[model samples]
Target: MAKVAIVMGSDSDMPIMKKAAEFLDQMGIDFEMTIISAHREPDIFFEWAKGAKDRGVKVIIAGAGKAAHLPGMCAALFPMPVIGIPMKTSDLGGVDSLYSIVQMPSGIPVATVAINGGLNAGILAAKILATSDEKLLEKLEAYSEEMKQSVVEKAEKLDKVGYKDYE
Candidate 1:
């Protein structure tokens, strides 16, 4: 099975990046993680992305804060899908990162999640992979249904107890 690569620009992003890793682990999806800054180490980023396909990486989840270019750069270098998770930083509160990731040029598209949306990135990658694998597609469908059921169950319980009484 081709695994996912979880790359972050800095160690500070680990806390946010870990959420994606945890989600992938829960889904039984293999993933590898590393810290590589696009601005500081462009060569390393290019090499890693170029070699990702041969290394059996089907998808990449990249997280970065200000001026986030990791995901866009990877998308340009690799043909595989790239999911961008914008991390919240002090300066721009992640708006800069969000725009950097979402505004990709023609021919290269990077799917971007909300700020600090690591979990969603992981789930999106799984959905992409499920397009080809029947078993994974089934699992993804079941997961979505389970989430719906959980929300419905919570509403039912709230109705039975009444919100005022619970409070």
Candidate 2:
């Protein structure tokens, strides 16, 4: 199975992007991370995408805000899947980033998550990899069950004490 590659447009996005790294770590998925800006470091982005397949990378998780082109660029250059996380910037609250990521050309598609939704991007990447990995599939199933149990437990607490009282 191919490992995931986590790329961000800037170091400023690391705070949001770290959630994806944490998720990958928890799920025991191997990943590589780097800051490769599509605008500032175009050559590096192209090089990374061109060699990603040979480097055994199966998916790419890219996070950027405003004119977010990293994900789309990577997807266009690489055959593997690319998950885009739109970071919530100060100006447009990340709507600009979302549109840039989601409005790909007909041939290229970047799977995009909500603004500042790096966690979901990580989980989706796990899901994509799990299609060909039995171990990852098992882990994902367990994770889903755990999430369900957590919600149920929270609801039970809310019922016993009432929502306001619990808080």
Taken over the whole model, the C-alpha lDDT of each candidate is: 0.90, 0.92
Lowest summed lDDT window (length 10), candidate 2: 36-45
> Candidate 1: which stretches are off by over 4 Å?
none
How large is the C-alpha RMSD of every model relative to the true structure? 1.4, 1.2
- Tens digits of per-residue lDDT, candidate 1, 23-119, equal 7887888888999988898888889889998989999999988888899998998899999999897998999999999999999999999999988
Model 1 error, position 104 (Å): 1.1
Give TM per candidate: 0.94, 0.96
**With candidate 1 superimposed using the best TM-score fit, by how many Å does residue 163's alpha carbon deviate from the native?**
1.0
Model 1 worst lDDT run, 10 consecutive residues: 158-167
TM-score of 1: 0.94
